[model samples]
Target: MPLRNPCALLPRRLQVVASLTLAVLLFILLLGSHPTSTSSTDYIHRVPYGPAIQSSAHQLVENLPQIPHDLPHVNTPAWLNPFRGPAHTPPPEQANSSSGEARWYTDFKWRNPFSSDTTLDEERAVLPPLAERARVYTYFESTSKDDKTKKIELELLQVWRRAWWAQGFKPIVLGKPEAMNNPLYRAVQGLELEDAMEKEMMRWLAWGNMGTGILSNWLAVPMAAKDDTLLEFLRRGEFPSLTWYKGLESGMFVGSRGEIEKAVKEAIAFPAINTTKSMFEAVGKETFAVEADHGAIAFYSSATITAKYPLLATKLSSPSTAVQGLALLPQLINSHLHTTWQNTFSSGIAVLKPLPAHTTTLIQPALDIARNLSQCPSTPIPASCPPNKPRCKPCVSNNMLISVPPVLRNTSSLFTIATVPHPYTLTSLLHSRLDLGVKFVRRETDRDSWTVAATKELLGTGLSSFSRLPALKDFVAGSYGEARTLWLVAEEPVRGDSELDLDALDWHFGFQLPRSPVSDGKSVTPVPGPERRPPPPKEEFGEGPPLSEQELMTERSMFMQAQMILRDSATGSAKGKTRGGSKSFAQTREVVEAWNLADTEVWRFVRAWDARRQLERRGWEEEEEGFLGKGTFGRWIDKIT
Candidate 1:
């Protein structure tokens, strides 16, 4: 009995192992006896990659590391040697010139900027010239009729002029008590109050040929003077500071003359949308339903563009005024002939939503003409297209409108009007540099639940087609920027604290918001800093509070240094001096310098959004429906059939 079963005498572990081995052998035999049509070998052959190999069966495989783990350690063959041998050997290049074309899987390109270095050249090319002369255009909207209030506003403007003078820029004071009466001010009355004000100020600045300017409502003091050096950085095109703001200040804007002109041209090209039926009837038939609230009406105007055969109704606040961004249809149409086609073509129409809809009446006719032009064919010179200018026509349907104005009829591309939810102030102030990023600051206070509710409703329902998405940051580099729009909606209501209010309006409206009492016309003291803090340290003779002098100076100095670094790196590249290790080192330095001065919160988000977009776009390319081998064929079939 003791010798009968060696397995029974074995240890517990050995006994269990023997039983498992027998079970496996029995199972394999059962599988082999009743083989299915698809065998394991056939299944293995159908695997996505090559057939699975029994690496463990090889003699030396047991000690060899795994495939990926040891892949880098594998010795290179002599044929694959990258180095050039002797002088007799032909020179070798790493990349084949013939195969330089982008590959579907291997090659990649970023549609949006992920790094400052990638866009440095583009940014440099678009930088605004630091003009020889700079002028200050200020606007102050007064709710109080008291003479004392007007006096204080004038004093504030004087303070700003003195500040600019200290920085060596001539300050032409164009501020008056009635400055806010400009038509742009009225257009944005019901929406984006501060942003509209800034745009109105920008138009006035541009018309005056004031190359350098600031738009402020005299609510807060100037943070810095017009910076030409910064303009140099801005002209390069990438993340240029076209519109700047301080954390705790009033609608502070400093931009180049070029920015003003560019914005004015865009504003003029596309008229503002007039919500009044009488005015809209003039542009085209008022097809869309009109909402009652200011915000809702604004939403409908902009959202209208997303429709099939979309027609936009845009009107300038006052077309008759020479300083008006959308003045005199005939003269404005002629002015477009001298500008680059991209100036008119790339940007269709951008409308400021104006009140007192009368001023915008003339723009309707122009918009109708543009809508007809959009319908004109993209190819083979339509008779209506001008011989000299051939660009993307603003087309609606295939049918041509013979009633179109003679000057506008022959134009290659008619401007597509973009009726924005907010006034085009931020759009105009930043001008083309607006593509970098946009941040909207909304002030929701417990005092006004109606406002909070209205804000949430507008933001949630998608004021513009872009804001419809929940992840605004995700859309920053793509849809929002692509659409040339930025709508910063508040997620929830906030307490009306000075700091919180200042931060919300920081990007577009930097002024310290008036408190409930002040807004209600009650007398309240204007404290420079936060409401509770001791007054900020004043400049000599207590002229005004100097809050950001050191910070501003430091910022300006850093930008100057970065400018020099960029110049040197560019020169090195041009001269072909830096190559190999030196070239790479220079490039690394260039990247660091490009973003060295970008410390503002807006830029921080811009960089983060861009990086995320790059990563997503890369991953998306492998599975995107539009690509050749991706899902294009399936999508095409789905569409055709």
Candidate 2:
């Protein structure tokens, strides 16, 4: 005590100075403010997050199909699923013609689950296999001088977790660094490491204005692949790119598998457009939309394109890139047949962008350039149509066409991964891909229209849980740590909005029916900007708008030379499922309900809790390890319960 008095009781002036410093600090915190700090990993959302909202909207539980009683359920889809009408038509052309939609859904070639060794990355890494809550974790394994990055990482995960849990998701997360299992996280526990973390989320929305592939970049971010390229591409600023893009925005194009085929076929009637080795880049993107700090191709161009060609992508493969790789060749072929332009590659006329799946129709734009721009007839140069396709009279022979190597990348596997929530609806999503196509529509972003009918129904049911949602409230409250298992729903994009409402914890969740895409203001939401593109131009490049009969015949003649280029994505490959596929969000709900409503192993664990026994009376690990010991999700549920 005497020693404590000596130093602690420094000179009166020194003590006064210290007190003043502390007071100033308090005053600055209470009155003035400093710029909030964020982590690099506070990272631009690795995926486009769905519109966040807490409302009385939900789909009726009755519409959900029963869990398959067997290890495999027939690919048969239930009515009212993502597929529209009783026929569950994926494409009118084939829905009525195909024997079973089963042939349309294919299996996955691989499923890369979340894996990480770094402590900092423990919370925001890995490509979770679940559908709804794929989380990410990052590590700042830097020197003592680099603790700032580590703190930022931790802060980012915490804020993300808060946002996700508040949105009612049982997130598959990369939790607090201290909670990390890595050896390093253990060493940094005593310091105020989290002090510099930022609590605010920087708000912004990204429309994949990058004209081509949003998938590769989205999936690459969590993998720590170059993300600046994607951000730059979106900004329209040139960055190091495998290729340059001169295409239109996706939202501007009207897409549909069969419809595209129909349009292309009709356009093919034009003696002008030729189809050779059909060239189109998948511009792969993971379509999950939300980032959980884990890895994944959050949304590839295919996912975006599929949003328009739901029935087609669904009929093709699940979200796992592995599955897509297996079906890649086939999917491309299919898309080619539907889109109609021949191989611009062999003919030096491939879509200005090589990959077509991830992009929209720019046939007219390509045609416009062909008309106005002049090219060296002998070279497969940019700006002009190829000179070599079956001698289209407009050009001569000997033009060397620029060619893309027919070799698919190691596609041995793409360098991509997507974290998905588990016991998820991979199957449902697979089926929903083709089968659920009719439910959502383009521009169906209104909050009040029937377009939101399905979402309203879902949130409506989820809101009922609000009465028992104290745990959810506590999680969101952040100040109070309350944990309880509650209903979670992810349907923001269905009704489309940017910010989420905070007080939606106590409302009942509901669902409404899907309406036509043509809703009057009833379905339109105010998008911050505009949707503009020019119409097809008449009068192109050289000879008067009219090419002589010989030229028209020559242009038409080019089609036969590049026949292989016409792939038809409209009719997706055999519908299949694989060991590598992810679970769907819808499937996640069903699984949760199945466990809650029936006698199951998960329920068994929940029932073993003996809350009445005194802590001292039981052995250390044996008694309390009931529900928490099962698995990550099991522990998560017990926390919320």
Best by lDDT: 1
TM-score of 1: 0.20
Clashes of each: 30, 140
Question: Which whole-number lDDT from 0 to 100 does residue 224 have in model 1?
Answer: 19
Q: TM-score for each prediction?
A: 0.20, 0.15
* Local accuracy of candidate 2 as per-residue lDDT tens digits, 1-641: 33465437688889888888989999988886644695455556553354422221234455677775347656655663766555322321212111211111111211112111211121121111112322222112222233433343333333333332332222222123213432323322422322221100000001111122221221112111222233222323222232222221121121222322332223223332232211121112221122222221122245444553344456445544433342332222222211111221123321122112211121222322222111222111112221112222222221323222211111111210111111112212212222222122122212112111112322343432222222222221122211111111111111111222211221111011111111222221122221311122222122224345564444333322211111111132223232335433233233333332211111111111111011112232243245232654312112221
Native-referenced Cα lDDT, model 2: 0.24
Clash number for model 2?
140
Clashes of 1: 30
> Could you give candidate 1's per-residue lDDT for residues 1-641 as a string of tens digits?
33567688899999999999999999999886745676778866665542334443454577776564224576445567668363232222222111111111111223322222322322211111122434445543434454543444344444443333323334443322233443444433443323444445333433335345554433223221122243233223332234533221223445565654454334333344232222122232222222222110001112221231121122323334312222222222211221222233443432222221111222222233233222222211122222123342423233322221111111223322222111121111212111111122112111112112222333443353223222322333332232233222111111233454333322212122233222222222223334532222111122233326564454334434433443454455522223232233234433332332221112233333323323333333344234222332211110111
lDDT of each candidate versus the true structure: 0.30, 0.24
Give the poorly placed runs of model 2, Cα more than 4 Å off: 1-182, 191-541, 548-557, 564-641
